[model samples]
Target: MRWGTFTSSNSVLLLIDHQVGTMKLIQNIPFETAKRNTLALTKAAKILGMPIILTTGTENGFQGPLLPEFKELVPEAYDARIARSGVVNTWEDPEFRAAVEKTQRSHLIMAGVTTDVCLYSPALSAVEDGYPVQAVLDASGSPTELSEQLARQRMERGGVTLTATNTLIAELARDWSRPEGSELLKLMVDDVLPPVF
Candidate 1:
């Protein structure tokens, strides 16, 4: 299927476990890259006017709160700190599930700190619920390259389409003629696309 089939209005962006808590153990994808993609996602979501749902697990003392940058990105999003423990799978969070439902969008755009535990779980759950899920794989981190591959494979099997942050931004832009076009192009150049052109 075409990757950009889900437009901004029909999509819901879910940022799972982007907390300073989960940021500590990330390994495979360099922390800087993950941070950039996460930040890019937040910025794109805000620009596209997509519904933003943010969730954190054990943000109180066990790990840490969501990064200040992300919180600053979408100060109006429904931010919730779920009380459940054990499991990077955020679909189990009541608040997360409710927020997803509230968005009322059938297409889900997802990314998380850990590829397997954080990104994979919610992708699978959404697939089972008959929703089209697009996972930003590179934006999601893992403990190792091995785990990252496995996480991506599992989600693919479950029908989650994988994409990178740049591909997604370009797809959404569709053309550099929209009102937000130039600004988005600048964003891709500054964040996703390198200075190769």
Candidate 2:
């Protein structure tokens, strides 16, 4: 996979299946940390004006809706909450595909609950469909460490760029001179990452 920076116009952020029940199943990382990183990523994307897609899967069933905290952060982005009948892969959902197609962006920055399912499946599909997909590792979680590790390997093999929230923030900033650069720095220290000094 060729590495490149993210420009607001060329990239879109996807927050998928971040439902309450799903969030409770993550065992590889602290649930609170994953939620925090996910929120930070969303806030950074919002500040940089990146096109975003917020989605939930089987919300009317056991998974529940997108986390209220996340919804509160990106209230303006297109929200796709799948009803009782829904596909596990959001990419398989017509509404999701339509929203992605409508964005016209070639690069996708994605993070979600259940790294093995919600994060990996669509990432592979998007790559197959010709979109460069980047998965924010720390922002996604799974039921077990082994599950998350295997999912990461599969995604990497399938041409998805496995990354972290900080990397995405830096890629979007690219230059310290840009006004958002400072905001990015503040986000890094204050929210997305641990403070240094």
lDDT of 1: 0.80
Please give me the total number of clashing residue pairs in predicted model 1. Answer: 0
Model 2 over residues 41-108: C-alpha lDDT tens digits?
Answer: 88888888888788887777778877887557776663443332568888888878888888888899
Roughly what TM-score does model 2 have, to 2 decimal places?
Answer: 0.93
> What is candidate 1's lDDT per residue for 4-56, written digit by digit as tens?
48787889888887778688768987788888888898788888888888777
lDDT, each prediction: 0.80, 0.84
By TM-score, who's the top model here? 2
Error of 1 at 121 (Å): 1.0
**For model 2, how big is the CA root-mean-square deviation?**
1.7
Q: Candidate 2 regions off by >4 Å?
A: 78-84
Q: RMSDs, each prediction? A: 2.1, 1.7
